[model samples]
Target: MRRALLAITGLAAGTTALVVLKGTPGVTQVAQDRPVAEAPVAPGGSAAPAPTPVRSAAPSAPASAKPSAKAGVSRSPGAKSSTGARSTTAALKATTSAPKPANRTVTGPVVSYKYGSLQVRITLNGTRIVDATALGMPQSGQSGLRSDDVQARYSGTAGEVVAKQSANLNTVSGATYTSDAYRQSLQAAIDRA
Candidate 1:
C-alpha cells in the first residue's frame, strides 16, 4: 500500500512538473497538428488568406519597389504616378475645399411642464445640431425625479435630433415627461437658430 501511494504521487508530480515546464516561456515552435477549419467565403467573393510571415536570413526589400507581376499598375510610394502608367495605390487629392462653418449656440426658454421646468442650449454647425446641453433639467421637489436617469434617457433622443437634423425625436422609455420637455426646448433652440 505504501509503495503504490508513492508511485502514484511520483506520477502526479511528474505530470504537474511537465505541464508547468511546457507553459513556461520558450516552447512555441511546435507546429499545431489541428485539422484546418473551413474558412467562410466573403460576400464580395473568395477572399485571399492573410499572408503569414516566415523567419528569413536575407534582408527584406521595400514593398513599393517590388512590383506586382499580375497587375499592370506600378505604384511609387509618397510620389505622384507618371502619365500613361496607372497606379492602384494612388490617393486622389481633394478638388474643392469645404467652407468652415460658424459655431452658434441657441439657448431655449425653460418650458414649465407637468414634471418640472426644462431648458436646453443647442449648439449648431452649419444647420447641423452639434450638441444639446440641458441647462435646467427636471428638479427633484414634490416628484421623485432622478436627474441622472432623465439625462441618460434624454441624451439618446438629443443625439438622434442632431443626427436627423430635426427636433422630431422618439421619446426614451420610462422618461416621457423629460422627453416632452426636451423636445419643446430643443424646438425653441432650433427656431432661434
Candidate 2:
C-alpha cells in the first residue's frame, strides 16, 4: 500500500511540472498551419472576390489602363510636365481678352516743368499746385532731376504760384532733357492758368 501511494504521488508531480513549463492549456499546442477563413457574403447579392494587395514588384500602371499622350490628365497631383508645354492656352487667352485699356486723361490742368534733365508734371487745383509728379523718368537709370529739385520746389512757394512763375529746378547729372520737358509742360500749365 505504501509503495502504491508513492508511485501515484510521483506521477501527479511530473504532470504538474509539465503543465507549468508549457504555459497555458491551449497556447503551446495551438495550430499554426490552419487555412484562413473567408468573410461571409451577404444573402441575395453576387459579389466579386477581394482584390489582392498591390505588390512593389508590379508596374505602377496596369497594362489595360493606358492614358493617351494628348490627354491633359495628370497622374500625380503636383507632378510637372517633362516638356514644359502649357495645357490651357485657349483658356488663358479667353480670360485675358476681355480686359480694357486704362484711362489716361488728366482730370485737371497738368503743369509740366523741367528741372535739369528730369521732366515733372504738377497737377494744379486752380492756381495752387496740389501735387508734383515725375513723369517720363526712368526708375533706375540717370534720367530725372535729383534731390535738389524737390528741395528747391518745397523751399520756395512754387506750389502756390504754380501758374505765375514757371520754375525750372536744377538738374543732376545726365537728367537735363527730362528736366527741360517737365519745365516746358509746367510752363504750359502756368500759361493756361
Candidate 3:
C-alpha cells in the first residue's frame, strides 16, 4: 500500500512538472526541443532565415525532411529571399537614407552705401554657404575698385563668407563701407536661409 501511494505521488509530481514546463508562454515546443539561432531581421518587417534544425544520428529522421527547414517559416507576400534580401536591404538603405538638400540660392536685401546700393546672393548647400556673389554693387570709379576688393575678400567658395559661414568678416582695407554693406547683405541672406 505504501509503494502504491509513493508511485501515485511520483506520477502526479512528474505530470505537474511536465504541464508547467510545456504551458509556459513565449516558449514553443520546437524551441524547447532545439537551440534556435536566428539572423537579424531586416527593416520593413522582412523575414530572416529560419533556425537550422539539429539532426540526430537516429534513423527515424528521413533525408526528405532536410529541405523542410525553410518551408516551416511562413513569410508575407512581399518578403524577399535571403539572397534577394541583400539587394532588398541595399534598396531599402538607399531609400531610407535622407538625400542631401539641393543647393539653393538666396538673395539678400539691397544694402546702400556711400557709393551705391549693393545686394548679396548666396548659394547654400543646406545651412552652410557654398558661394557668395555681389548681385548689385558700386561699379564706377573709386567705388568700383572698392567693390571689387570687397567682392574678392568676402565672396566665392574660397572667400570669408564660405569659410566663416556667417556674416562676421574682417573689413577689407580701403573698402570699409563696401565691406560693411556686404556684411549687412550677407547677414540678411543668412537670416533668410
Candidate 4:
C-alpha cells in the first residue's frame, strides 16, 4: 500500500511538472527536430505561411468559431495578417492626412549690413531671428575685414534687436562674408514682411 501511494504521488508530480513547463513561453511540446509544416499556397500564386497551432497558453476563443471583422482576428493573435496590415495602412494615412496648422510668418527685425567685403542676411519672425549667414567673403579675409568682423556686425545687430524686443537671436559666428550676406538677406526679408 505504501509503494502504491508513492507511485501515484510521483506520477501526479511529473504530470504537474510537464504542464508547468509547457505553460512557459518559448517552451513547446512539439519536438524541435520535427520539420515545420509549410504554408498552404492559395489559388493565387503567392504562398501564405501556415499559422502555428494555438498553444494552451493562448487566450481561449469565444464560443463562436467564426471570427468577427471588428474583433481584429489574425491567424494567431500574435500574427500579422492582410486585414491587420490594411487597418495599419489606413491608420497611418488618417494620421498623415489630419489637418495641421499652416506655417506662420515670423516677426522680427530683418536686418542686413555689410562689413568690408562680407554680406550678411538675417530673418526675424516675431521676436525670434531664425538664421544669419555671410554670403561673399573669403576664408582668410576679404578686403581689410576678417570673417570674425562680419560675424560680429551681423550678431551685434541681431543681439541688439533681441535685447530690445526680448526676441530669440540665432547667429553664425566666424564667417564674415556668410554672416554679412545673411544680415543683408534678413533685412530684405524683414522689409518684405
The prediction achieving the highest TM-score against the true structure is 3
Better of 1 and 4 by lDDT: 1
Expressed as tens digits, the lDDT of each residue in 9-96 for candidate 1 is: 5555454444333431221333222223433333568842321222321223322233222222222233344565543223222323
lDDT tens string, model 3, 77-175?
344666546433354456767888999999999998888989999999988899999877868899999989999989889999999999999999999
Task: Report the Cα lDDT for residue 180, model 2.
Answer: 53
The global C-alpha lDDT for each of the candidates, from Candidate 1 onward, is 0.57, 0.40, 0.71, 0.44
Can you write out model 2's per-residue Cα lDDT over 110-188, one digit (the tens) per residue? Answer: 3333433333455554455555554444444332234345434432334422434445555434545544555555556
Which candidate should be chosen as best, given lDDT against the real structure? 3
TM-score of each: 0.45, 0.27, 0.54, 0.26
Tens digits of lDDT, candidate 4, 1-193: 9667666655554444444334423324453223445444435677633334532322344322333332322233333455536433344356557564443343233333344344444445443544444455555545334555644544444554334432223444555344545545545555555
Clash totals for all models, in order?
A: 0, 20, 0, 31
Off by over 4 Å in 1: 1-98, 139-146, 156-158
- Candidate 4 structure lDDT: 0.44
Of models 2 and 3, which has the larger lDDT?
Answer: 3
The list of candidate 4 runs beyond 4 A from truth reads 1-84, 88-115, 121-132, 142-145, 148-185, 191-193
